[model samples]
Target chain A: MNLIKLAWRNIIHDPLTLFLNIILLTLGIGLINFILLLNTQLKDKFEKNLADIHMVVGAKGSPLQMILNSMYHIDAPTGNISIQEAKPFLREKHPLIDKSVPLSMGDSHKGYRIIGTDHTILEFYNAEIHAGELWNNLYDVTIGAEVAKALDLKLGSQFKSSHGFTDDVDLEHDHGTLTVVGVLKPTGSVIDQLILVSTESVWAVHDHDHEAHDHEGHEHGDHDHEEHENGHAHNDNEEHDHAHDHEGHDQHEHDHSHDDHEHDHEHDHSDPNHHHYGEIAPRRKVNDLSREHLLSQTEKDITSVLVRFKSKTNFQALNMPRNINENTDLQAASPAYEINRLYDMMGTGTKALQLLALLIAIVSAISIFVSLLNSLKRRKYELSLLRVMGGKPAKLLSLILLEGLILSLLGFFIGMIVSHLCMSAMGDSLYERYNYPFKAWIAHGKEGLLFTGTILLGLTAALLPAIMAYKTDIHSNLSEG
Target chain B: MLSTKNLSHSYKGTQAFNFPDLLCQPSETLLVIGQSGVGKSTLLHILAGILIPTKGEVLINDTSLYKQKTNALDTFRGQNIGMIFQKPHFVQAVSAVENLFLAQTMANKAKDTKRVHTLLDQLNISNRATAKTYQMSQGEQQRLSIARALVNNPKLILADEPTSALDDSNCNEVIQLLKHQAEAVNAALVIVTHDSRLKDIFPNQLELN
Candidate 1:
């Protein structure tokens, strides 16, 4: 009834050509949508990874690599430093330094990267233990959501340490089992793939191995003594000494047995006597393998310390770690700076893709122009007839303009659906690799702008065709025919 | 109701027409006869306010048509004039009633479905009102165009070789239809043609050189 309706009817009259034009326009819009979605998802992942800690302190290497390792857990660490060496800076009670969580990573239990950290890491990272309580002692471990799910581990289940960071090991440790006490809720972070335990647990494993070596040395000495006595026809004292050696070896074998005979003996003896026992009475504690001996055992060290600031402070507190690194032999990195640098390096590719989308949109606009201009020639007689029947030039021009607008809007709608489906397909891989929660229907500010811009471009493309329609010499055209 | 005085026009700097004086009173049919390329269509275009004369003026109801703005002149033409082309040039995608409705919008008036149906009935094209222009026969399309033109109740009706393709019987029927419709609205009817068969249908004739 109106010019716009008439224009739409005319476009639909030739469905094949209109469909082709719609496809072209849809491709242009779809490309733009895909780029926008990718850019948004990547930026969101980066920001989420940077949410907790303000700075990272470690042994010096590439700053970007340090960020990728500590924040995202995707790259190799910058080696470890002695915690004693880091103690002096930690004691400097700066007003800006809110809290610090030391990180020691090297060991893994069943392919999950084990992170030795303090209890403050949970609060600092806003992590909630979904099912069980947090680990309070050595050898008790808490695993992240994906870790639990992948290994089918539950609270109270004990799993042995595998050889490497990945689950492709041919070697497994004997009796080096860790108890899972908690499983963390899914935060869509690097923590979701990590296994967390207290720093004391890391030291206990090494200490336990050292004690086993000492027991083996004692057994060897007893065997040598018994062998020396067996070679001689002995006096009564010598006979008694050989008997003592045999008893001692027997006791050693009994103490080192894997059965619960010793535990049953202890439990029966301690039940009635516990009330009379004093707090200071010497009782065997877990992993109390003498701190002096434990420190002298091996040279495993910490990887980094993630420092959270109290508020929006300056980079002054950041310089403390840098000074320590410069004056001594350690490394410090500002995650914010490294992330910005990384974005700058990757932004060029994003910019290139955006430019390509823009160029394609322009070409699409020109295609629309050509299509409408061509239609003008074919519809000349119809245009002249309208002119004689009191159709104004403005109405004729608006009709063509409306046709272009309809094409662009339809293309935009189809493009959105296409982009959403594409994102949904990539969502699993994206979350796995980068820990990004990419929802299909997430809206970006630039998306609205892009659609509006396409509509405007379409209107602009129609301008020339509208002018041609307006300037149609109805009298000359009619008279000639 | 319509007159042209000392009308002359040129195309590409060559004089194509020179008409001293022409007039058409209300309720009268005037036929313009000429050979091929003798500017009969050009004269009709000028009289319909579609083309401007190089030297002379066209007045409709004592007002100069050339002095009005382009849009205003279009509106005035839509409300006061009707035209039928040699071949019916209906909007190919739309039905006949829709074409008539589009004419109402062009005249900046609200839709008058009653007027459209009445015009279709009078033209005997009521049965084909819902048919698309491409779907209709040539005669049906011609009649639809005539209905579209008269839907706005204009004061002048201009026909440019409207019956050239019709048989003798159909030609007379078309001529009589235009005459009857023009007289019904008290409109001045002007027909431009090279066909000599319509010479006896109109009492007043202008032979173009």
Candidate 2:
């Protein structure tokens, strides 16, 4: 039998102590590996999404909250600003601004926010059309790649937007159904998790409610006058087209493509042939949707604006954010500064966990040392017998050392597997809650260092006991037996 | 053949030991009988190459054992000499047969499972060959220890207090087994013991005073 076999037998013979030592070491090593996996992936995902966008302009509120709500889409928006308020920066040739794409967000479908944005938002993310054409008309929406995949949305799929970013559909805007016109390719950024639509569509859903009430009033007024005269009521309904022109509303009626929509509305009402001109009400509302509704489609507000400057080093670029913040109500937050503050906050907790894991490992190493030393003392006579049976001092030393290596190596492998299992389990819950893609099996560079360190600890722990075994006076020990 | 000349030793602040010259021919059983505190174990250790005596020349098969370097002496002892202690001790982790294998391995010899089994069968502990050494009865443990010592077919076998703790029946059986195994390998067997019961078993004797 080899020394390794002998060592293995000795370890298994006393299962309790070996198990205690291995379990202690496993907890320590597993925790260290857990921290390594989280820290590495967290840094990677944060850096990946923090590309090129330099500043966020929003209604005055928490800068970090605005960045999280706007850039990461995982927090509540600060508030919205008027289109007029953000217009100077949105222009093609503003002095300090290179590009300002406005984002209007309020409604969501299935907890995924539907962002009302121009096509330039696609350029900012460097997204391409994965399938179908871009939205060309109102009520047409484009889905991001991950959104399409996750929600199982396809081209021509229809869904109604909920009033806010929540799963509760109690406040759903069912006035119109949005058809999926396109799906954007995944850019591995926050864009992959959004639904894109035109800003006008945002207004269309909210504006329909007011216009529906106003059209009801107009329908009642004309119907009341016609029905009271009794005979002309039938003729008044036939003269509806003539009446529309005479009211100086012909331009508005001719400008709308609401013929199909009006037909559907008329079918819903029992006596609605006279309300054929209800289509004209909706047409007028679209024309004069008003700066009031446009300012905050529901609240005439956008969550935040992601801004890129003409030059980071430019003097105007430096002063522009302060100028906007002090003179106007908008606040500009740097993504870099906010994200660093975020890391510093999280780093402290992880560092503490890492230290605790290291301490556990050191204690386990001590356990291994004490166990080996204690066993050596108890087995002194046995070792001496081995020497008499033609065993050398080096051979006995090797046996002790091998026992230590087997214990620690087993602990290391089990610890690594446990750490990965924990990550995978936690990753599923995190993804379900936050839509954050966390891969569990990613091996960090420091894991190699951890493995080497553990094995070295095992060997070093055995070193002293092995030396004692080597120096045993075989004759004296054997004769004592 | 095995022989020792002018062997003596002195412990720190302890009385010195002066031992007689001794010789045993091939296939012969020599009994070195002594009382307690007579340094019989010390003499056995010095002869086994385990301890370097203050004055001694131990020659086995015409080669001087003590004339070699410490490591070389260990190697020579492993190949040519086998010693059994008073209470049979083993690497408790391994089986009886595996303990024999470990002996061969330590001696830097190729493993011989067949020889180990054969020796265990001859010693009448073949049934316990696969049992852990610690699980065996004391008599069985001693017999297995004997099998381990004889597995290598050494030139000389030294057994210290081989039957000191045994009853009459067990002591006679153990002495016969040692003599039978030693003669089978054509090696000289020297047993050091304080047990007076062994005086009648062997024809050759060396009495230490």
Candidate 3:
């Protein structure tokens, strides 16, 4: 205890020296803390996004980009597949399949990406509605948390689609405004920056010209009544008015068109019982045609599929995904595997930073040694006096060592503080750019052990100077006057 | 009870002193009077075991001081001997009391605060106990050095030119303090000096020519 007191006194006596040491230590620890926190946050984000999905089935492209788009919701999708091609797998009920969510991307609302998917995507994400219920009909929209915040959007808010990736230009369909039906709670995922609508809505906007083309085709043929009954030839002005009413007006139009088609087809038949049968046949044909159109649309294209496994295994179920990519026309990736590989590639820089911290600590120790050694010469007579007055060499040695230990511990404490402040400042930017959450700095477990180890190293570095003090010849040095 | 017989010493291959015989009994102040360069300092160093004699033995209470190991010699010096140099060499960074405490530590004893204060009082410098060594006047530093020397109550007191840097009054005060300390410990006092001012106070004196 006395030795410690002496050490502390020595440091307190020299504020400039102590401050310099603190600065060096703070810089070293600050760099280490920044790197460590960044690495932790990146790994956390990757792992969180990796959960719930087993594999990504996407268009043949960079497997990394496919995983990035499908799992992280960043980057453009390779392209989309028709629902028909996705239906066989969806119907197969394979235990391994779990559930499939179809994602169609290409449009943007403000700067956030627009995801056109079915209600199944919401269910897959277990997304909670913060404002209203899920969209039940085409054109109804739900927005993620960041999308709502950035665009100042809320439930019932209307927004037009932008031309490109930004909200700058007016597009061809800028006249159409999508009403937001719900706002999703923040999930700390890529979903947070997205605007999700029904897949048909996406097809509806892009295929509006197709609707006009169908109208022209119907006018040329005897299917003019069929076109009106199919609900494709509604007045453009009435469609605009119905779009403003978010209360199932579109569904009502479909039902009315079905009833009119049934009555017309039945009248065309001569026999009454034949009329009943003709009405049923038309309904079946219409249903079959719509189903076939949906199936054919999704057949050739798929951006990606996220696969979740039944058991914890490393690349065990990778074969099917790889084969799909190599044999079939779609690409697959394991997010966990790819992310681990990415961490491995990044580990070198982290290791180098750790090495630099170690090196700086060592240099600091040597500096302590040199400082004490130099002080020994100036204190020779004083030391001799202590010896002649009955101070044992061991006690003298301890006093010198105590001084070194004090300096190092002070430096370590200062360094830790510096690291904490720096990380807190950078945390917001990291979340903004990478969707990562920053945790508080706490020296527990391995970090605590490292801190203690550094202090011990500092103490050990004082051993040489202590030995020099112990070897000083008291009788000879004192009587030399 | 300190004695040396046929003691001789050299520094860097040059002879510094050759003392045929010397002795100082308990409670006695034996002044070794000598001219400059007559080996007063060298003899004092040899007697204090600071320098190893090349030709003879230095015995303190029948123990051969030169034959002991370095660490043992240090321990023996700290516990049994007190040294006063021509100039007071206290640790400049520490206070006078701390210097005294250092002396007690060297002897492996608890700091005797009361004794240190009393010794400083006797030397008329007790007020300077908390003063840094560098801040103390030369006379006060010299007196504090003497106090530090006596803090462990050593059995043998060795002083080399202890009054050389002091005025007559301060010299008299230091001589009285050293004499009182030696008598209090029942130890032998050996003072080596070129000045003959202290001649009348010592009944038995060794004159080296």
- Tell me, by lDDT, which candidate is best: 2
Over B11-129, each residue of candidate 2 has an lDDT whose tens digit, in order, gives 88899889999999889989998887888888888988898899979999888988987677767787788877678888877788888998888788898889988998899999998
CAPRI-style docking class of model 3 based on DockQ: acceptable
Best prediction by TM-score: 2
lDDT of 1 by residue, A1-481 (tens): 8877898888888788788777777778888898888888787767876866777877778878878777777566777665555554343365777777667665566556777776667766577899886766456789889888877989998876543344445433332467888999988666777888765454334322222223334323344344434432222322332232222322222233221211111111101111110001011123332223222322335577787776646667756656766787777777888889988988998888878878888888888888888888888878877776677888888888998898888878897888888888988766545544577788866887988988998889889998889888998788667
lDDT of 3 at A131: 88
Report the lDDT tens digits of candidate 2 across residue range A273-388.
Answer: 22323111122213332223333322234556778887877887877777888898788888878999988988899888989999999999999999999899889997877776
Which docking category, incorrect, acceptable, medium or high, applies to candidate 2? medium
- Candidate 3 residue A64 Cα shift, in angstroms, is 4.0
lDDT of 3 at A2: 43
User: Comparing candidate 1 with candidate 2, which one achieves the higher lDDT?
Assistant: 2
Tens-place lDDT per residue, model 3, A35-130, is 666666676678767757777776667777677777776556666553444554443355556666666665676556677665556655667889
Q: What is the lDDT of residue A37 in candidate 1?
A: 86
Expressed as tens digits, the lDDT of each residue in B92-133 for candidate 1 is 777888989988887777899999999899989899888887
Q: What is the DockQ of each candidate?
A: 0.58, 0.66, 0.36
Q: In candidate 1, residue A137 scores what lDDT?
A: 47
Worst 10 residues of 3 chain A by lDDT: A276-285
Where does candidate 2 chain A have its weakest 10-residue lDDT segment?
A264-273
Candidate 1 residue spans exceeding 4 A from truth = A52-54, A57-63, A75-98, A104-116, A126-303, A308-332, B62-64, B122-124
TM-score each candidate: 0.75, 0.84, 0.70
